[model samples]
Target chain A: MKKVLFAMALALAQTAWADGGMDILKSQCSSCHNLTGPAPQTLKELWARKGPDLFYAGNKYRKEWLVQWLQNPTRIRPAGEFYEDHIKPGEKHDEIDPATLKPHVSLSKDDAQAVADALMTLKPKSDLIAKEKIEEGTISKSMGEMVFDKFLGCMACHRIEPDYGGLSGPELYTAGDRLQPEYIASYIRSPQAWDPKIWMPNKHVSDMNIQKLVHYLEALSQENKNGK
Target chain B: MGNKLIFLTLLALSLPALAKEAARDNYRTYCVQCHGMAGNGKGVNIRDMSVQPRDHTDAKAMSARSDDTLFKVIKEGGLSIDKSVLMPPWGDTLSDDEIRDMAQYLRTLCKCKFGGN
Candidate 1:
């Protein structure tokens, strides 16, 4: 049985090596991404999600950003994929592996677009997206930054820019362009609902605050002077 | 804090040889980065940190805060209690009971308890 499994794995790797895009998703991305259907129903199930669920990538990611990111991927989550994957003894403050994480596989432009196209078809939560509206101008830069950094304490876990915040959560500098507004609001409303036991706290964020945070992220994405 | 059973439990390694080990291991794993091996808050990360990590060895300081307060800071991060955001939450990492153990172990470090002042 082990021999058979090894053979199957070898075949899959060869197939992905020979092609890109959808083939890559099946053979490579499938190892981590849940590409099939319904999201994790429980905490145990959530743990199996080694990478962010691409099953609903269509609903979560912006297609243009996905295309660009696939061509030249960067680290989003400061700690590798999971929160406690590389936590070890005799280290400093929840260290994750080392200086930085290993780079993701880069693809050609055409391949990137192809993968993006394929991923965009996996939209499961259109209802959630339909209710989202980008109500801009409500949160000013200073006010938004104040709430994001202090009031709500998102900056502790999430980074608004490079090397600015705690290194436990995903970076949010490109969240405006990378993620859907509705997704952001929904996630902050309750991170555990999406990925139970995820490091991000619910914070019991108010409805107004959620909108403000989303607004902040959107504005931050727009105000890019440097760094990826 | 409780009846005789609880008192005996408390007498058992001051309640947490197991819990103490857990708290020590957790401190080593998480807090020692900034709190240091001796609970002196002179952790290796201090050089880069803008503010100093709290000195657990400072009996006067640690004693001033209540166990519930310590639990809150550990479980919810420093910002939840209007403290520094630099103190990241361990809610997702450590269990509630574990946090409680950590709070108790902290008492051992300072060798002091809250006087309700």
Candidate 2:
């Protein structure tokens, strides 16, 4: 009878643990993130959003990255996600006090793992990222630089090298180290798909270019690693 | 009458200064990231880019270009001028008046006239 009771208790505990993940998400994350989403369609609606939509978190972020980031949160957007709202009339953005920025809520390792597991299950459009993959060493570093600087004008917003390029967007020099190749391709193809109000405009890049870009990112990351 | 004339002259002088300040503010908002805070072209992105952003403070280089060229580059982008595509077009984002103001501001940065004497 004790053996049977132990087995039953184990099953019950497992079920509760599964539910615990969802419960934690609803209680902690739903306030800022759109856990369920059809990303904001218009700029006005996008600006209204307080945090990045996580409905496609499974497709967008690596599970390991999510777990680590949850435990030790840092600002991803140098300028706030809605930069227009953050820039004061007579001050430089970099001059703004870091203390004034809203801090992201940190989580314990167990909670972060549970929350990441729950978030990974929230993938809605898996098809968008299905075919994207990073192929290593296909494009030379110089060729990738050409595509980034000359062809796409990406240098205007994204930084591929340290201290070079525009600062309006996230630095791309560390992107290969930081992002999934599929996520990079998907975001580049249609930034609005992930966040409608994001300042990045959809450049309608071709599939071939997308491949080249991912390969370039991987190459850049490798270069960064070597340089370091 | 003398006081009124002096007041009018000061106001006239301050108008350009005020406009220049406004232009500087606009530069801070948009160009400072890539162009540096002092228009030295050593922006934060300097390490990432292959081509250097134009240094507005370089009097020799700035004086060589015409105001029309500066206006065109700002409005249409470097691609229009056979320059690097790294400089994105601002025509859709900025008004004609703003571009003109920015060009004037660039002149102040270089401390040189655009047209050759």
Off by over 4 Å in 2: A1-18, A89-100, A131-142, A161-163, A222-227, B1-84, B87-117
lDDT, candidate 1, residue B10? Answer: 66
Candidate 1 regions with alpha-carbon error over 4 angstroms: A1-21, A37-50, A86-100, A127-133, A225-228, B1-65, B70-117
Give per-residue lDDT, candidate 2, residue A203: 63
DockQ (C-alpha based) per candidate is 0.09, 0.12
Clashes of each: 1, 11
Can you write out model 1's per-residue Cα lDDT over A1-228, one digit (the tens) per residue?
999999999878645643456786897788777888566544445445667878888888999999899988988876665444533334444345654355678888877877887787777777776666757656788999888876766664567777676555678988999998888987887675555445465576788888899988988888863433
Clashes (candidate 1): 1
Q: For candidate 2, give the docking quality class from DockQ.
A: incorrect
CA lDDT, candidate 2, residue B91: 57
Which pairs of residues collide in model 1? Answer: B16-B20
How large a fraction of the reference contact set does each model reproduce? Answer: 0.05, 0.25
By TM-score, who's the top model here?
A: 1
